[model samples]
Target: MSSSTKPRRGLSALAALAGIIAAGVVLGIAELAGAFFRASATPVIALGSTFIDFTPPWMKDFAIETFGTNDKLALLVGMGITIALLAAVLGIVAFRRWVLGVAGVLLMGAIILASVLTRAGSSLPDALPTIVGTAAGLLALRVLIARLRRTAVGDPAGASTATTAMTAATGGRGATGVTVTEKDDAATGQDGNEREGATAASLPSAGTSRRGFFAAVGVTAVVAAVAAGGGRLLAGARNNIAAVRDSLAFPAPASPAPALPAGVHPPVPGLTPFVTPNDDFYRIDTALSVPQLTADDWVLRVHGMVEEEFELSFRDLLDADLIERHVTLTCVSNPVGGYLAGNAKWLGYPLREVLARARPLDGADMVLSTSSDGFSASTPLPVLQDERDAMLAVAMNGEPLPVEHGFPVRMVVPGLYGYVSATKWVVDLEVTRFADRTAYWTDRGWAEKGPIKTMARVEVPQSFASLEAGTVMIGGTAWSQHRGITKVEVSVDNGDWEEVTLAAEASVDTWRQWSHELSLESGLHTVRSRATDAVDGLQTEERADTVPDGASGWQSVQFTVK
Candidate 1:
């Protein structure tokens, strides 16, 4: 803590920074190596997924509510910042107490190892990259700290007697026989104060060692930056699965949907499009990154509680008799009146026939489907086997599935919420029971069976829209999927409900467009909509948040009439 000891402490601090930077470089190199085999093999991704798995439901909701589809990217950025800060701390600790630093690095590796092991289908080889990266970090820390320790600039005021004697013998020069400063007072016949000042100024300051440490840091940082860029490039190159999907042609559907009526979607401005484009579709899932899978490498394994288990390749799916149907899919996390629902024309084989081939046992009451990235959903066995057109879909809206929407294949069940039914990149289906197993969200406090609730949204006359006073057309979409919307009603300022004209229903599995015209005099007007299902099931009026199951409430929007 002495003034003369400042330079040595400063050098130690620099060494610690260098150590951290070097460790980052080592890990980056390891990440590049892992990318050649699989993108998911990287340490950060494994750790991120583990963090997501353990995150509480409310925190997960908070992230989704805050970042929307970019929540995963936000999580990765947060994790990166956390890791960098921890690494810097470890580097500093290692500079002063190397043993503790080494221990910390090993502990970090152990945590990553545990994360990898906990992942579904993880093998022993999955741990090798993290272990190797951690060992390299430890080595870098050791080398940098050792170089720092060898520097001899600790105390300028207290140069040893040997140092003074050596300086005098060499005529106020360094022991290396080089002139380091002006002559000491002993040689120049000057006072003690002058000699002491000259001695302090002339001492060899560990310049060579400091320069070497800085060079190491610069080179390591540059290399890490290059590695990161290269890793991203390689990953992008590996994601050519989209090209493969585009090249292949979908066969004619054995059972195609009835052509949609022309006026199915009203021309009202701001109304939700009848068919949500593949790119504009809402995506809410636990995957931190999209899985890049080509049809050639895709495979589905059907087993568990079945008389005969079987594996179906992507080619097999293509060859199977495919049907096309229009279905509306909804996310369980969608709040009432949320835009997390979409209607699409899907092409695939009937999921019931696929299960029938496996001959599920009588007691088997659920089908636990899993994605290539290890996400799982448990669909009710009866729902899947029923004549509701539940399917293993391979195409959406006349094109192959988009990579972000599940490239090779996915499950599409009309009535159930996507959390329990629509699984993307689906690879496995284990026939089981709710008592014996659970899906991802189900384990996190959601209902095991997530049925879609009837809901209506006023897309036109969106909140705060300005319009001229007189007749105003209020149009929107209402979906009860499978149950079908029998009647839609609109109300202004919580006034008496008025029935709206319904467009021709595409099918029981798709949403219907409805509209109503109201005469307004002036100022602000609050409009609300509600729907009744085919079975006369009235849409719930009380509002509810999305949790344990789906949300329910009347959709309302306010607007102004000049």
Candidate 2:
């Protein structure tokens, strides 16, 4: 509002900006320190994961639909922006009122601490970084605010006198100011005003404080950048677990899969690949950062409701007799005909054999498997103990499982949706009961038992594709997992359904490829495909949203014939 006050406000604003940078520097240092402990336990990641865990099902679906595989990246970006805005506000508030700023910082620390504590494997030590970082941020805010306060508007009368005295002492102008003071009492008001103005002109200006604040902020920013870069480097160094995975090899399967029969893959263009490649396989999990566990340090513990509790090291798992089989895994969240299903050749020890050793009590009907990162799945004990090829997979598609896909070891149970069966980075299998406990997804409103619904997906003549007006090849893949696909039928424009040529069945646990040909006329056409499973279960034609358990419906695609 006043000419003298404008520069003071500008300086305070700059100081506020400096305070924000200092806060960032403090957090960067905390993250740097945390790299040596547990990298995944950092405040941001822990809080972000907690937020995701509490996210509602519709929002999850919306995110998947909107950002696809980049949904996690989008969430991180949103969190970063939200944090930055709050930090900026805190900085400005601290500059105005230091106590309030400190309270805000502490509140943030409490939130982060609470989030960390609730995490899967977190302990009191995980709160150390956030606590230390908050303290540092509060100190930085106080120091920067103190420095800026020197230029803040104060008692005008006292400030003017202090300024004049400082100028006279520093510039050796005491004589001139003293002489002017000697005449000022008897002089007219105008002359007194003129003398006061002269004194004010000779005093220090606000520009100096502004310049100093900027310099301090610049230095703090550079240091923060260095610390952030160092943290990344340290985290990267811990990623050597990937190299260990590459060098490590699981033992040959004692009961190898049967040899593939000829004509397993249908000779149809645009048909889905019979076996989804490891790299292209769909991954939908709760891991924001992949847990890097070296095989030497990895251990699996089986306990709870078991007559005999046992622990197995990674070496022990590799030494056990293993079996290789092709299994199709599906996500419960996958919509009818979605791409979130993949068939892979898995190599691992049979889950049934391992559970047999544990000897789960009869009362317990579920195995609550948990990942190293804290994600949990409630798998039916009967499904795992049955003659099915449920296993603790060590390798996928002849290679060690990708870190993102779950390295070291993961579970692969056929017939069931991944929400209840495929536990990655698996560490503990607690033989429990469905009545006594629930899993991560189950608590979030998903069904306890997730079975893969029979479905057929069209791979060729995708929705909105333009095809030439002639014989058009309609090809796709159908999957029933435990129940093999018996027949695939295609219907054109609500017309009669016709059976498509089905590929030879490899095993009941994998998907089947099928194709059909159709004579088309120019215009738009809606084509749908459905499959009948070996047990007389037909893929439903009614549409249903993927939730609770799984989706059921015929997958329809519309294309124009040229």
Candidate 3:
């Protein structure tokens, strides 16, 4: 705090900064290495349907169309490179410098906090081990510095070398009786007669410098440990979430796929489309990989704007009445018409049941649903209450929800497009009005209430299609999502609509896939599909893209009658 002390303090600060930079660079390298390991694994193509079953249909569509299950490999590799570059920059900036070093450490910590450090649910508790390790390093550094200062710079024997030389030089009345040469005397050494060390002894400044260096390093370690520890704890505490992920293993052959009504052919060959095999569903989301969380650790908080704050446990939801309903989910990002939607049986407690415990006030219009991983969707409470089967589903197709699918619990609303309905890995349900909040997607320029638009696809080749004049099955899927797909019509290019045989309607929640047999003549042909919903809304033929709202139009497929 004094004038003379300013230089030393500045130097110490510089040394401290260098230490932090060094530590952060080391940590960055470790994280980048982890990224490399992830990149080397085989890309997960279909995360299995169970993992994707409950994801907001819109989110699922986006991942497939944008990242594509396999292209995700590139993103992992790119993030690794970025992290490594950041580390290199930090290392350079920290080269015996303080401000730069501290800055680098802070940057590295932020990257880790926002991305890498949050690998699994409840990241806060698991980060304790890191705190313990960094703390131990600082403690050791401090104690080592104190001991080194005393032994290396403060040793008396080490400091006495100059005193002996001085006594022999000024021998005018020396106790040992050694005569001093006129040319060598400390008293008159100014003109080559006296030596500076002989009279005014001094220790090597190098030793002092080394001692200070160590002391600064020790201080740096202590500060870094505190900073990192505090950050980890704060972040972990703020985002504490756990979702149980059950395994959806391949089914035994005997459990033949669910029987479909007379006409529909499943999307995949050889199996019925209604019963999505657990192993064959699509998975896409921000989580490049799934985090496996345990049931005992899972907690669902229902605490905002509620008369009674209900903290629901996995056991509580599962113990209530179990309902099984089949539903189709679609992603908003699916192309003007895309393949990112699917149908599957989901099992769980009705969402209305959970909200009941919270006892929402009369004004509560929206339930802002959130995940353990910082994603949210504002589902209108009115929708859930009106649809009795809408649930916080835990099981998909008769098995515990798979980890990739939000695992322990997820929201399931029929009729609504995924944008406002399906929220996977759900952790919170803030009972509030629409005016009170905006969800993650809403902030990103999407319509607040993204209802699924009517859509239909053509499956088989008909007349003029170069098919051998024989019976051919023409089938495809149509979805109004929550609104119930009613009539599906197939037509030959610009031909009249012919009613196709429809699959049994599982419920308003499930998609109604339909099929019809067509007799074709040998030639090139164009087939198209269109759907009429229960609300009398017809699938539009206009070309409108997915923007602030969902996509719509007829689905056309070209083929030849061989």
Candidate 4:
């Protein structure tokens, strides 16, 4: 490559590096500023949340299917890559066209500002971080570009003085009678001559400019790293809700769940535990970050179409006659045989009693439950008021609710999908007609009411697992929460279905474990299982995608017998 071409390419790369560094500054400073306000106000969080809000249902399902519980992390990583690529482009653009680059930076800031302001409970103060960070990034970009330009064309004043001195020393001529201008051009490789012959006197200024640009980049990177880390630390320190949750004490339930029956958890290895541990419970929600809240400061407000509006404080909720029940919660996005269902012992006050005190209007048929993060679910009022143990849950599995699961308060309703019934970090409930409102998922085209479907999964020999040719135990769990699993049937290699030994049922609201012993010859095989609910509703054999409602199909796993 030509010497001139190489320098230009190098400078362009430097420009892109400058852009990336500026972007780092932008995010770091914004994060630091957000530490003083709210973490959700940061540009990344706001944008990620906005993206989630606008994502199509199919994309959401794809992400859930692809990433499982780590979907949020996958989204953040994707966002990071996209932003970095865009930032590099912005940097190169600014290096080439200064005004357009500035405009791009401002436009990004405006977008982030809109995202932050549009968040639930957002106020004017939330825009400050975006504004301040954008300004900082713009300034950094301008300064870096200036240094890069200097590197491209060394200090004009210094070059001029040096040229004059050379001309005077050479008497404005060379051995070839060439003009000083021509000699200088040749020396500087302006005419495609040798670059090694470049004047030594002209190198210092260009070298200094390059050095200064690199130094600035290094400093900016360090600042960005420090700011980002410090902001995270500060935010964590400010949100001491986790500590509060850890120190909380719960009163004995006025009505505790019955003792679990023996054999509820069969001896079969790899079977899902009867009671899902709090840490292992499935969490699928739109929250980009978990909402941190202290029980002491938490309050639930009930209003809209009610005879009388009432606010329940955390203290009042704790003092109420609480009830504990074993319930299985399912996500509507859970594909057939997906591990998105879990049974847990929940402690909370009955929602029917709470709503009874509010005295709902005659026409009200739905309760719009909203999370602090602005997610909402439309639950049928009759379901909450019925004999079903729908409750405003405070604790899970005998311990205070984990922050990620909703610490201060969450809603737990058996038999319904979480998209329509289970609301974590719940703060408000509006009694209203289904016609009067659409929830977060409903607005996105999910069904208005999401009843958990009867389903079963194979767990003992996982999909694609290999086992010895002999008698093998096929164990799994089945659920039709609130309807109860009556029987589970397993079939091998599309053979006749046979009844499996069902574990003792815990409650109508919890999943039942089932296992069957089968002999297998050495070969590849597929096992399928289905469940029968208490109402004799057989798990469907037809396949349906998880959308508009829950998924329906028999779960089949293939394994190899050696």
Top lDDT prediction, candidate number? 4
List where candidate 4 sits over 4 angstroms from the true fold. 154-208
Each prediction's Cα lDDT score? 0.80, 0.80, 0.58, 0.87
Clashing pairs in 4: none
Number of the candidate with higher TM-score, 3 or 4: 4
Which lDDT tens digits does candidate 3 get at residues 300-344?
Answer: 888777789878888776566766677778766666546667788
In the predicted model 1, the residue pairs found to clash are none
- Which portions of model 1 miss their true places by more than 4 Å? 1-23, 139-215, 465-471
**What total of clashing residue pairs does each candidate reach?**
0, 0, 19, 0
Q: Write the per-residue lDDT of candidate 4 for residues 191-241, one digit (tens) a residue.
A: 522322354334457778778889989988998889889989999999988
Please give the lDDT score at residue 476 for candidate 1.
90
Worst 10 residues of 2 by lDDT: 153-162
Q: TM-score-based ranking, best first?
A: 4, 2, 1, 3
Error of 4 at 308 (Å): 1.1
Tens-place lDDT digits, model 1, residues 425-543: 99999999889999988889988888889998888887888999999988999999899999999888989999999988889899999888889999989988999998758998988
- Tens-digit lDDT track of model 2 for 183-218: 554665555455555544554455564455556667
TM-score of 3: 0.62
**Structure candidate 2, residue pairs in collision:** none
1 or 4: which has the higher lDDT?
Answer: 4
